[model samples]
Target: MTLTFDGTVLVPVADPDDGERTAAALAPLLTDRSTAVLVNVVEKAGGAPDKASVEQREEYAEEIFERARGPLEATDAAVETEIRYGTDVVDEIFAEARDRDVDAVVFTAREGSRFAELLTGSVARRLVKEAAVPVVALPHGDD
Candidate 1:
């Protein structure tokens, strides 16, 4: 099916590079009426100790959003950023999408070894399989 970017879209970014790549891939598809909500999910440790401080994670999210904004802002689409916290990354992304009433979840799949994906449970795979809204996996700019 053809993917159209007419309504609000939830974009889950992993890092600064991911933010840039995903935005670059999505930019061409967006129009003046489009709304791109860039989201960075900071995984919490639940009951366990956290890997990084919440403040640090939020700062990192800001950096990611900054990188992502360049390409998206160059397009006619409006850009907004959000920081979400959860124990599961995929769940957080879906929650954000549902909460914002996004038309779709757009992202570029990160490069990784199949073994690593299997061990960690690939977020990309889960997103496509379980999303309540449409999930669009855009090809990376380098791909």
Candidate 2:
């Protein structure tokens, strides 16, 4: 059976290490026919990304996506990707999963504590609690 997953962020420093490890862990769990997606959220309009900043983000995203292509392809799984932004991250992630009718979302767990996440207002435990679909939060690490 084919399974679907939601991958968040394509930032070099924030991704690779964590996401790659999580994907590795999930590799065995998915079937050969499974289809996984690397979904990256780019704020449709985040106040402003200035020309240089926009270019920089795109460059970084390109690098991350290129690197991701290899591992996902090796799993004998089809890969899908997307980048969008205009809503709260958690809300958008859950919405995408439901819309895709995927098996679950595979994202990384915040490496910090609840208080830290709350203070940062970044995606983390809130996703697990609020996501309408099944959400798999992988620990942050390289191994």
Best by lDDT: 1
Cα misplacement distance, residue 7 of candidate 2 (Å): 15
Q: For every model in order, what is the number of clashing pairs? A: 0, 1
lDDT of 1 by residue, 53-107 (tens): 9899999999999999988878889899999999999999999998999999999
Q: Give the TM-score of candidate 2.
A: 0.71
lDDT of 2 by residue, 29-119 (tens): 5455677766665445456543346566666656656666655556666667655454466666766776677777776663677787668
lDDT scores of the candidates, listed in order: 0.92, 0.58
Residue pairs whose backbone atoms clash in candidate 1:
none
Give each model a TM-score: 0.96, 0.71
